[model samples]
Target: MTDTLIKLAVQAQFRTRPTLRSVVAQMLTEHLQEKYPPLTLPVAQLRLALPREGGGRGLSPLVEVALDYLASGIFPDLTARDGLDAYLSDASGTRLSFEQNGTRHYDLAVVEALIRELPVIVQVGFQDALMAYWNMPSDAGGSRWQWFAGILQDQLRAAAIRQLAGDVPALQRINQLTDYPARETRSQRHGPESSLHAYSVQTRLVQGETQVTVQSSDLLLVDGKQVWLCNLSGRIEAYASLDAFGQALGSAHGRPVYRRQPHLATL
Candidate 1:
């Protein structure tokens, strides 16, 4: 079947689906596994050696506040405790009692309202979030991060949609992508320091199913499109494609794919 190709924005972080509801569903599904009704604030659990005297304290400065936000049905996909603004209880207890601030006075009614709305809000939010991914480049042929693009497929797509179908009408959209995966540039660097690992994805869409696949190779991107494949692990086997990348990952014992950042041991 003929495939459609589209160029994506350079800075696009995600590909969005056609509808706003889909975006909301994706966001909620992404957060559902998070610790809800959090008993403690994020990063609240800190360990400190007891002073020679007698001092052991838990609960960070933001603990109660964070808890309040959780109670508010805020987004759970957040990475930090400081992000607990809406869900955690505000300090003024305006969320609890006499409303000095816009926060509802702390009352079971307020808490109950949040609890009642949590699932619905999250579902809609996540559906919208998934739609955002489509806004990114779905054209496998042009995708430099083709491997990751391939994983953004229908099984996962349907799974994401199914999550919302339980509560909201399923979002329906037509998505199509086409791409090519050839080393844009061949490796020229010879020394040990000249090495990198990269991946590619190639896809074709058929009527009933989306055929997505991924590949990997060692390389570094240059000048936007040039690729320099490398031999990092001291072997020619380093030049692996998608199928080989999977095989190497499954068979290897120590590490499959290791991308380390500054101060990160193994990210």
Candidate 2:
């Protein structure tokens, strides 16, 4: 089921610009079907920012990033409080975490647990699939699993608020916009330096109607704190962050106002 779902996704990557993976979503969906239940929706989402060879930030495969982060913390003995998407330590370690599934967000764990009861089988299968997806050697799969476990530990060990905050605060801030009902992806660019995604937005109108949209090129930046938006005139209309842009879009337009929705048909 998982492999079938993933196969469907290969084409989706091209169609969607960012490739989508449905393995986890499918596994759970199928498991639910077998259990006489079903997931609420078709669960494939996640635009893999497949990394380039020369080495750039956004280019690395997300799994590799998550795996590398976890591997950095792997130790001899420790237990993890499993996060369905990732994991963390029950013993002493640094504070960090990452998800093998490429989506940028998760329901807060406490709320998630109340919603899904940890579903340990999902964890077991997820670990197995993640290993296979990465082509991990069978003999060292245990240690590889431990690497993921170590990632959980590192995150669990983070400073109080930071632990719960996220893996990368800058990127995390940008992701919050996706949760808002109105936000939409406008465009995407893939190249050696970094991957760029543009969004179309209907900003707030405390006084007048203004939107958050931008122009782009082969290269762009999204540190999560700020996204640079350029207009047809080649002037950059900057967004302080995805959230700031979202609030401005959802609220009302103001300072350095904008209202005309840019033509995105070409994108």
Candidate 3:
């Protein structure tokens, strides 16, 4: 049986299947649980200390002595208050709002400020993920997959930091990546101009239900007659002709022994 491969540019982030945000949250949660076991803290209390929540421990007489000092240090714009809860309430009330295309958007600078106060572990995780990601060359094969994976790793790192700062027993974030679609860049190749036009190519063989897919990122012009396909997370494959590339792809995917239609540019 032969396989099929399709390639196309998605308006959303690359790799639309398997949500990246879910993957990221999963990684971070796993990391945290590994480091800190036996989750027992109440969910509400955990929310108070998380980075996105501003690392506020909520109301407690024991926290009052340090409330003024901490609130002033964390929320400089906040005024002095008689109690910790009052101070947190005042800080929470402070918000930044803006309108875009008649749509209202709120910026939680105060919440982000708390993220900055996360412990060193979270900070280190973020830094490491970033370093690994940035180190990868954009032109390399599978870089796009790496890019998506890296972004998730970074997000997880950030979440982990929030979890640590909040003293949360566990991380709880949903993967809503599918909500965002892949976008086209100015230099993105498409249609006849694109060497590989399908966002994802799939072919099936006659004998079985197995399908073959080629995550062609871009086409590299080796010469006037030769071209190379940069796969998503694989090595570059050289094709003597576009027709040959299609045939090979079909064969790989278990396509029948026949002249395969080329999945390439019009040229």
Candidate 4:
């Protein structure tokens, strides 16, 4: 059932982005001659995120499978209690007491219980990290999984850096604006050596009672006003002035920001 659903989903032609729920609904309706039970929404979501027990099935959710693989393989001894306690430990093995800034953000017991109950929700991309490890090419030598794990670990660490450094609002804004997958591909010139970071943003502006939308992937340095919107890959996107960019972000209430649109059309 899972394999058939995924195959049909991949084959289905659509004008918009495909969602797991929509695919599953179509499958149950057309293929299986069944209607999705109202109470099964949570189960449906969970099944979409998890792979079936044992192997040989094609097109399983890689993320959940990765978590299961990690639980059984790398940390074979892990139990519910172990997962709960594991969340409290930092990279240096120091136990976090949930007492940062002399204020507690979460009850330790509550968080521990949550972790114990839903271990997969602890983090994302476990399957991606695991796949990178398993699928490492023969050319790479000496602890390939370790290298992959290290990079994945670093990315996870970076995501939490704001919370670690006590910049909660910056982290919140980042999470808010970056609802879609971030542009992970980095250019050599735009790497860590430079202070600039690539970002995608949609800015809605009101021009004489008409709503205009500006969106781009080449938007480097997202800090409003002082932005380097130019595409460094010789595309020559935009290098708008501070006030011009600010106005783009300062639209009236109830206006929706688009994901992206043509550059020249926005202008």
Compute the lDDT of residue 39 as modeled in candidate 1.
Answer: 23
- Least accurate 10 contiguous residues by lDDT in model 4: 42-51
User: How many residue pairs clash per model?
Assistant: 49, 22, 29, 0
Question: Model 2 TM-score?
Answer: 0.17
* TM-score of each prediction: 0.23, 0.17, 0.22, 0.22
Model 2 Cα lDDT, one tens digit per residue, 50-120: 22334421222322323333345322111222321232211222112334455233222422232143243
In model 3, the worst 10-residue window by lDDT is 170-179
Lowest summed-lDDT stretch of 10 residues in model 2? 75-84
In model 2, which runs have C-alpha deviations exceeding 4 angstroms? 1-195, 200-223, 253-267
Per-residue alpha-carbon lDDT of model 4 for 1-267, expressed as tens digits? 243553454344122333433333333223212221222222222222112234221222323333454365432222234123222222333333333557442233432233243344323333443444455542234354444434333343354452324756444333332332233333242343432344456655545557677664444344343343433222322335545654554533575443222232221
Question: Model 1, 1-267: lDDT tens per residue?
Answer: 111221234233344334433333333223322423232322222111111212322222232222344456452221223322222333322121233455342233333344345455655555544544444454445433453545433333344343434433112210111122222322232223323323332222223444433333332222222222223221222223444434443453565343221110110
Which regions of candidate 4 are displaced past 4 Å? 1-116, 119-217, 221-235, 250-267
